[model samples]
Target: MSLSPQFLDELRSRITLSGVIGRSVKLMKAGREFKACCPFHNEKSPSFYVNDDKGFYHCFGCSAHGDAIRFLTEAKGLPFMDAVKELAQAAGIEVPASDPRSAQRQEIQATLYDVTAGAARWFEEQLSGIEGAEARTYVKKRGLDDKLVRAFGIGFAPDSRGKLKMALATHGHDKLIETGLLIQVDDKEPYDRFRGRLIIPIRDQRGRVIAFGGRIIGDGEPKYLNSPETPLFDKGRTLFNIDRAAPASRKSGRAIVVEGYMDVIALAKAGIDEAVAPLGTALTEQQMEKLWRLVDAPILCFDGDKAGQKAAVRAGERALPVLTVGKTLRFAMLPPGKDPDDIVGEGGSAAIEPFLAAPSPLVRVLYNSRLSEIDRSNPEDRAGLRHRLDDLAKSCTDKILQEEYRRSFTSLFFEDFGWKGRDRTVVGDAISRTRRDIKTYQSIARSALYGCFRFPQTLLRSLEDICKIDFDDDVLKIWREKIVDSVSARPFLRDDGVIAILEADMISPPQKFDITRDLRFSLNVSPEVGTARLTRIIRFLVENEALSKALDELNHRVINDTGMGNYVALEKMRADVRAKIKVIRDQEYESGATDAEADKEELGGAAGQSAASATA
Candidate 1:
């Protein structure tokens, strides 16, 4: 059965080679392809590889190679006709009958390939001839050398419409029109579609010319023109320079996407060859899939302009529904009012390397783009942003990936606003109690600093805790620093001596506070009290501050997350922190009371001794 070449091409394009082979062989994703143990020749390690982009399976172990049909015939032991019928049915395409007309159509399709190749050669010749002098000058002015011009198959279409028609007349006007080289109207003579323009050929995976893109040499309404949709060319499914970029991407471990073919060429001239561009359209799902077949995350290097950002957003949206675990995109933005061409042209590939080196992830780009449209300060606007982000995350077909995206978006949103929120009622009364605890901790910190100044000896033991204090007031911080320096310099300095040193350094001691006055005074003057009271105070302050921070984070999580399991977990954590703070406060109060009583007894003993001495 002789199937038409066009039918066979469609069959291969529609069927994914990995999907077919995966039915029998276990395939694992290897960058730009899938790998499995060679089924024909068993081995421990995987030497068999399948590339859906190029539509072929190869085995390094046994050197077995074929396409979808061949796989079915050899692996499944199906006849060639039976394999073709099976694939055609799966692809939802009708198998062409092996008749005289099918053979004739096959012959015509073969000739069409020849016609496009012939036209590409003719355009190249025109570029190097007298008629292309203006186009050649334009190319030179753009910094393209002769070597690059030939490497990219850069050519020219003359101003005269009939010239291309006459040059390729032997191929017949019908074939030329079918390949989109000549424009034909109803009952009208066909003429050249591209005239007075510089041509760049668009090729398939096999490096066969399928279409042409042209840029006008001078002022024109449409700055760029592309060949109309032909049997061999579908712009949405095609990318410029894909044939060259596929291998380059395999070596580089990534592919670079630009806004135009010219940008791709510019990077190529700068010795960066792993670049491709969408053909006159925003990137489509088909185009993104093609890129994923080359690398996990292709870098989309768009111009740093309004339109370019919009293009990136569109590409991101298109990719959301089909996203998998390992497949994604990264975005690179050029400097404002510049492009890859401008960067490479000015400073060679070095200038563009930085932008490509640290491209933003797709999620960040999407989140920021949506975030920029709303007023972050407004509650309603912020809620709207969350909703939009949630919707975007839910669009992913992969459930695990969807959940991860949700977490990422949520984390990003909270990071911008910080864990602080206006809700004081989070997790019942936890947030309200935390607010009060913050004030209590601040007062304890103040009292600790005041106590340190009075008894410089206490500072010697708790010097580490003293340094850990987060003083909000500059004056208090300065005072604390001076006291620490004085005490650290002389560990046995008395209260009056330390005070004198502080005064000498022009640092004022903290004003006495009534909040914990008895405990503070007893801590300094009474050696019977020891350093335990001051140590407990500092520890209480530190623990309270840490608790407040942890509770704040949990509060934010509990409020933002709707999952019952997570909410319950976060609530329990908040409860535990509140309980811990209560225990610390209780211990401090009990210890303070006992020390106050001890000071009173010491005073009473001194009074009795003084009275007895006076009486004698």
Candidate 2:
């Protein structure tokens, strides 16, 4: 079905590139752009970017790029027309009746992307001038080296009223504010929003600068001010360090998710480059999916304090359900009152290496932190802590892991309660209760209750991606194996099956507390989203039939002449484009539509004229 132009525009407007991208990838706000793992390819890190203002997407992993339609066409296998129609439907806009105007709007949007690019260049050049000396000194003082500053495209925004606004105007362009490069207080006058600060231009994976993050020099009230969610940037959906860390993560087979800029930089400096951080907020599940694509296991490292601990809990909860047998997670806590940066700063890479080396298991971290606060000195506290511990233990759907945890934890109680001297362990009774817990994979048995309504067949790939990998530690390995098996079994089961299987399962209080979170934030996904994704995959496979067939043939040929086969593949793709043009021409001919009738398409007057002459 064809979608109207208006509908397409609205759909484009309704879905921020950041949000759509953020759903699958974690993005940290870098200036106005969101950065995260390049979902287009496997990586151990993030280097993909989505620009809301510019309406562009790019990935550094395999150098893929284009607008949303292009992304759908490539990633989801939507024909350009189908993607537009779907987006239009989603946006609730009827496609524009006037195709010509719809076509014209495309050019206007294209011009906006160009204008943004031009403005970025101007900003970079200005930063090199004396006016930018202060910003330069500031970044340097903050411990960013010259190469790092340049790699981040560190520029300076002059403290002037509207130098940027005027510069754009002088260039015969006035769409600066539309790109969020500048802002206007009143309709009459506009000013650059990023002036007089150390500018960090945020780039998508293709490394095109889309937005800016500015850090003010010392004593400034707001030390760091990011660009307002402009047309091109959204803070909630961007991940910092995606540009540099994606490849590292891809290569290393893991991703390290940190808490802040300093933490990311400290890790990078210490040679642990597969780290990315959020844009000064709690790490969202939206961010975790991004990491999932790059590496099998994504390690969550937060500060050691209360807030950091809370963040870790949230991250753990979000990522656990997603964990599969091979895919795993570990948590790292910084020393009290210190961040990754603090450790690196105080003692260099050597000091912080141990923390990364000995990251904590998510289960242990979550349950342990909560357990410490309870006082066994009182009976109520003891009961409460037992309830908490019981709940937590129940969260593990793997009976073996649950059993192990119960046994291990029971031993701890014996030691803690000084029961090593006395006999008859009450906690030992809790261990027996735990034996029946997680006797079944609930999601697997209840296919109808696939959590989210949309689950995918290709999800098997994701299932394998997360579940099949083993970690160095035996405890973590065992824990992940159960998660993988439970989630993988979900696509085939009925809801009753799930209940029947899991009813036998019981969790200690601490495990229960974390288990719910694990379902929400961890590897567990909603069946609806998963199923929809699978539907899209089915559609894509059908749409790319010609290419798929050709690829099959080409793969056979590549075994004989690898280099020549690649050339042949390119040639075939080029031939396919030409074949499409020929088909379009024939269709227009059969329809008896003259060039004049379709002049509104704006595919260059030359094509129209040639077709007109041909018809004549």
Candidate 3:
């Protein structure tokens, strides 16, 4: 908050606003200024013009205009600090640190991170030692060699109840539980994190070992076990081998995303280095965002099995909207009953390399999947197939991705069904294609909220990061901005408040319901520390007074813009805030009321009221 207008003006001068906006949005010169269609509002014409010299962007039609910081904060709805950091990184500029508390948390997480790396090395040492005969034999039988084992950090966790625990304890790692390395049953005895298992250390793209995945050595109830949610590891956010795979992904401009830790390891060992896998959980929007940092286009590569194909479809659905224009995605499936690892292990990575080399449209997969199940031999099946493809095409939100899918898919359908010529006879094809988007929107709905929650101090920063917004609709952007502003001020929410507020911002009731379900599922993951973690997330986003001011300004635009209208969204937001304020008001009445909580509440409520009044 101490940062003055002069300091901001100077900072803006040091960075090119066009270059910053160009990170996520493609910009071209339109005379003196750079012009691109307002990503914040859907338009056939370019109105979102960035005046490079002035270091500002103004969308005359939509009235969404701002500086480099504002672009980032609005585009992604990130916290103000987070947006600043994002832009600062893009500008190749250094951002000064604000609070020492963030530094402390980072340091603690670093220690836990080191512990994980140390444990992996220890496990690796055991496997390479004389006692690792069984572990060595198991991989060798699967076509992995000594080089592959070492490359993947393939190691054996001894079978004894407290073997690795004793090893780490001797090395002065008594706090293994906090590091998520040694599990304690009753605070009485520490046990090995992975017992008689094949250990696979999970890391971020930075190569920090934040968690671990252990594959059982023999027949076990749960075939694989991963580290529980820890401060250093959030299963939904981490990916396996991303750090090792990023260089290759950047060079290749694509990455092969797979199912398990071993899939990535096997692919890497087989000379396919651009492979990453989700860690101990389903692919999340956060993971997608993470992958976007490394590669422009990502290919979903699941095993050619029933479950894998299903997962691929679900993941692709979520990825489509987030995939920036010009950037693309494809899917690959190994032969049935075979995974990337299995195929590569049996016939070398060379055999599987061809599939990973190209991106295949999801429509082909969907079409083939549908055709194969409909008794293709029957004459009636041909008619049904034609209609299905048409309906599928119309449902797509992105024309470019859809058109590409259509071309490739039409070829396969003609060949498979033996139908020649462009005969577009699709049946039961509804004119308004039902929303077939497969992404459960687990994090996307909370995207606006989580933007604030993740970095409480800089709630407005996320919105400033994305130079453009592309929901393909103006009204939607209005709702999005309002939601971002209202949610950013929130320091933390009661469960019911969160549910109600999230639902208020969504396009439909089902979408709101989906968010509530998904958020609860993710939050319930770390039951022991859920409350503290949620509180911390809130504080991180709404970090400073300046951010709150910017958010209030942004929120007012959303509400006052007559094009957006007075929907239930604004009303619901008001009701939620008033109800929440009442609860705090009651608590203050009970306890010795402190000035701090009361004042922050007043500021937050006033911001919300201003947004509401603007609509009125």
Candidate 4:
């Protein structure tokens, strides 16, 4: 027997077209449709196309075309009946038996749809009547004009329980109860399920009303009410405004999931029609799957309140297990104490546009949510954050994805909390050696440089003579120049004032060398010690150089000279030079240690003074 047209259409709608075609063909998303090399007869420029909205695949090269069933029958070489059975199984549909009652059941289901549709229209008519005056005012207060009200089909339920039952009495009370328009009890009469609330119809992909959502007008218990699960309405699997959102999503290349029907309506009113919402529940895996069919990763824009943030976290947790490659969610939270409606009211659509354009990815949202839950500086709390991250990554069934997430989270954790990597030991050792070398270099330079900056008055007279010496170290030369500049700018310098000059010049320290830390050694010297020590160090350095040069000249003359008289004279001058060199070397060695000891004893209080200075 042939399958019914209604069953075939339902099957087609259930199975995503691109997903079916992608199993054999490596389909790539090209705008709203997917493209692949034609499987029938491929010349390799991706002439095969699949459109989920159209629920079919077509090959432009060979003119081959079909739905999911036809593709299996033709491309996979399966028989027509086998293809139909396979697709039916995948779609969660049972093939109708040849028995006549199956057809009767289908007809009865058709009547239930008609009943819900009639109730929706009746509710819409009530919104325009005298009893709907309150709802109309609520709508106007929400800034919804006539066009948006008609577009979203906003309606009202009369406060009386028997009003809906009486208005649709022709559809029968039992039918209305079956369609979830009324509630039934064991012994009492059935009454309306929704009352004194603004009614919103929930539709399926084909735009047929399958359920209803109601919001209480004033302060009432259970501010929002949704229809109970029925044969046609599975709340977990259905999203509000999906029928309208799909085409808009395709055009804009985005799908936005919000928290409620009112939020979706608000977004649509702001000209952002690509918005949908789960039916009075946290987002489910089935709902996310439905969203992914429209866009690879949908934007989940939740409110900024604590409840909304908690809802976002719940959605992220639910999505972890089923998060496959190219399928995820982006999270966008409104500003504090604001929802889409509130934002639009204050600043119009442009206010929420930036948030929608750049929502955080799923991994970022999960990472940030866990991070926000704890104080990272507390070791126990930080450990908890790490454990939560690992747990989220572990929930993923995809091994590659799980490992990638683990690596990313570990890297981010270390970078944020100042943890080192495996090679830190080697790096530390090298850095220590470089620091020691820098310390030695700074020490040698500071011997002569510190006195000049600390007590410029003592050295100001010797400045011309000191600048005449060609110093071996570049830092000494630079320090000497800084001292001359400081003295010229200010006639007499205080110790603290001189140190400030040194610090200002050392702001951008040379790479691979840090001398500023040891520069504090100058505080160990008093003005008298600095002046006396500087004179000794500078004189020893200059005189030692002069004696060494004179000795070298004498030696060169002795080696090249031919007359004995000249050689004798040169030898006598060399001996005199050697005697002078010995005295200078002795003084240099003795003076450096003596000055160091004297400065240390005189400034044993230097550390305390430096601490006070630092506090100041």
Candidate 5:
């Protein structure tokens, strides 16, 4: 039975080669591909390589090569038919009964690839030909040598559209149009898509030219023109210089994502070859995922101006929710009004090494970007900063990570501005005095529970464990059960989502306490401080509950006259629980006093600074 070429192409594209190879081999991302020790042959250093976009795995050591199906047959020892069936299943493709049209379609697509390859060769010929004198001069002026130009497959698109159309006319106009070398419009003959521009062929992972990017030699409106989406090209999924950068990234252990093709070529000329650029678009999720596969965090190189800073922030925001623990982005900003190409032209690639060495982390860039946007003088402006930080924290879907970010931003806020407009002494004294009684700890735990509901983001990491804890207080237990049930039903509730759930159920706190008052107390405290305090209180409750259970078990043992060991152990456990309670309470008091003194000092310093400024 013959499979359709289109079906096989789709299957190859769908099955990420690294993932299939990774199952049996320990594949580590090297540049734009994954590398592992050859499963076919034993070796110390890894030589087996898998390029997912290219849909093939190769071993340099043994010269083994094939796609996913071949790997299954050769490595897994499956028969040819079985391997095809398995791969088809994994790729979500249904195998059809023998079809002859599949082979014809495959042949046509192969011819189109040939057509694009032929056009690329023609472009290169034009660059070195008499008509390319102007283009060659421009290339020399940019400092790219013959070897560098040839390495990047740099070519020249002639000014006349009909020139390329004439050269490849033998291949048929339909093939040229389909390959994006020629553009066809309604009621008009097809002309070249790229005219009078420096041609840079964009290749797939396998090093086959898939599309072309053209930069107009002189003043042009669009400046750069890329092939529109074709059967084999999607701008969002394509990155310039990726074919070379992927392998280079493995050696450098880094993939530097620059803003443009010029930056990529400039860096390469400067001996920094592990650089790629997005094709006339902001970095997309697919691009980031690809970059991550090559390196844990690809450094994003942006311009140093306001526009560049804004781009960095936007990229960070887009990456936040989907961010896993290890996967992230680093940012490199060139000097004011400068770019990678400009810097490399002036001082060489090593000049930009310093910026790359200390590229700001995603979190730092996110915070600093917001700070640059807002006014810091007025109280209202500062409040806006707080809200913005909170929103960014809430955007994180990972509960533990979200809580950590919330605390980090809160700490930064307090460190820079300190608490404002609220009486810290009064609030501290009230909490300190009220929390002295053991019963108050339970009340605080209950309030913390409500806080988790108020800000559902808080429940992300702790919800499940908190739900399982056995509570002696009837009212608090009821609240815990309600929260656990609600959260279990809708696990991803955020912001006012918890409140909406409660409102729908008409749930209210027990009449013994005012829910509003407790909520205000919890909400008023700085999130980091509140979290610490509540966490400690919860620990005390859990520890105390364990002690009580032990004492009860001892009593039953004594009633049955098991032994004096039960009574002695009970007394010792009781003392340990009391000591633990004392330690927690004392630590809380010390921390509270330290924070209060710090707040007062900050306020005094701010006042003094203001008075000095006024006098001056």
Candidate 6:
């Protein structure tokens, strides 16, 4: 049985190559592809790779390479027809019959492809000719040059009902209508579907012109028009500029989904080649899946308007059911009333790169979108918000990721609005007191000292701040003096030397506490983190200590002072100190040290020493 190229392409597109190989191979994600030990040869290290974007798997050790069908045939020892049938069933598509009817249908589809291609060429010709003068002016006005015009196969549809019909008349009216080049009524003659507009060809993955999108050159009812779904084109499954963007995305390690064809072209013009667009609709799961084939997370660039934000949330909700561990979406928002085209035109790629570089993750977007709609002052409204978040998180089909989303949502909620429903005044006062307490500063200072002990270079780098850090614990204060004196003497003491100093003084590193785990982990692995980051962590600790002292002093003054003016002044000072502490903590969190690996073993014999000293 012979299979048409189109049918096979669709089959491959529907089935992820990694999902197929993973059933037997246990594939691990390696950047944009999956890697496992070579199944063809006995290898300990993972050298076999499967790329879903290219729809092939290869082994570096055994020199094995093939597509999904070839994998079934060669690796699983299945016949060609059997493998094809299995893939077709998995893709939910029927294996085409070998009968003459099937052949005829395939032939007609091939003819339709030719008709679309011919129409595209004719549109290109008309754009370069006098008929497309207005479209040409519009292109030039948009800062599109001749190279972009030819690269995108941009064309013009003359504002006549019969021009496209007459130009591609050789392809027959039925074929033209089938490809969506012309529209036909019950009794009236078929007419051109796109006219008086700038034409941009939408190509398939293989770079064949499958459809056309036309933008109105002048004032019109619908500003843009797209081809009706035909035998060759499914608007939801097709993305504009995907043929070019796929390889570009693989090279750049990213894929960008803009709002329209022009935005894609604008990004390309600005040297950003890895960009695509949905065709006149909200982004679909099919389009998103196609993007994931090229990159792990594709950035969805939407306009910075309420409508665009709503669309982003809708896209996120649509994607939740299909999201797996590594596959997800990020959202980038252009300035209000300004798109990629406007940004690129005004300031080139530089202006747009920052937005694309720092997109909010899908979970954050969902949380923020839902949070913005709630009345946080009302307890019932807050409860409703929590339920909505839970529902959105549960929408994810991946159980592990669903739980992760739930945890992330819960953390974000608590961070936004702390614990509620209790003795409101007592809880609020306790939380406020905790924020100003010396124990908080002690934890921070001890974590920083432990970090210095484990990574002595951090001690030298942060010597200035270390000398001034007022440790609440007597042992920590003495250990700090010894460390500073030793590091100041040698100026480059290794971890062993710092350990020696601690051992001589009968001091042990601070025990890890729940509140200081992030800071402690950050300090423990200070070598991996550069000096600048370690210094910032130490500086924040010092600043936090100062604020804690200021708050304590203000507390004492407020308790003793009887005058209203004096109490108000003291309370204001306390508020200012608390605000500074919050700012310091926020800065530390944003420095990205909080997510460092927390399971690293203590340096040298520090763990044993910590245990022995705890008992002492």
In model 3, the runs with Cα more than 4 Å from the true position are 1-96, 170-174, 185-190, 370-616
The count of residue-pair clashes in candidate 6 stands at 0
| Local distance difference test, each candidate | 0.82, 0.59, 0.63, 0.75, 0.74, 0.79
Clashes of each: 0, 97, 41, 0, 3, 0
Candidate 2: minimum summed lDDT over ten consecutive residues — where?
A: 436-445
Rank by lDDT (best first): 1, 6, 4, 5, 3, 2
> Per-residue lDDT of 1-616 in model 4, one digit per residue for the tens?
6878998888888888787777667889899999888766636588888989988888888888988887765564344665676677677787775678866776687788898889889999999999999999999999899999888778999999899999899999888888889898987999999999999999876567899999999999899999999877999999899877875675577889989888899899889988999988899999988787777889999898988988998998899899898888888878888887788777778999988888987787788888888986699998988998999899999998899888777766764674243334543454344334333333433545655655676566456656655666676677677777887788788756766787788832233433454342343555766665555555655654565556456545533333356456654654555555454334333356755775465355554666898999
Work out the TM-score per prediction.
0.57, 0.48, 0.49, 0.56, 0.55, 0.59
Q: What shift in Å separates residue 97 of candidate 1 from its native position after superposition?
A: 8.9
**Predicted candidate 6 versus true structure: per-residue lDDT over 151-229, tens digit per residue:** 9999999999998888788888988988888899997999999989999999986567999999998888799899999
Q: Which stretches of candidate 4 lie over 4 Å from their true place?
A: 1-105, 419-616
Model with the higher TM-score, candidate 1 or 6: 6
Ranking by TM-score: 6, 1, 4, 5, 3, 2
Our model 3 lands, by Cα RMSD against the true structure, at 31.5
lDDT of 5 at 155: 98
Candidate no. 5 TM-score: 0.55
**Which segments of model 2 are wrong by more than 4 Å?**
1-116, 170-175, 184-188, 321-328, 386-616
- Expressed as tens digits, the lDDT of each residue in 360-414 for candidate 5 is 8887788887777777787898899999999998888888778877887775676
Q: 274-328, model 2: which lDDT tens digit per residue?
A: 8888876677665666666566667877887778888888777655444545555
Q: Compared to the true structure, candidate 2 yields what TM-score?
A: 0.48
Off by over 4 Å in 6: 1-101, 419-616
Candidate with the larger TM-score of 4 and 6: 6
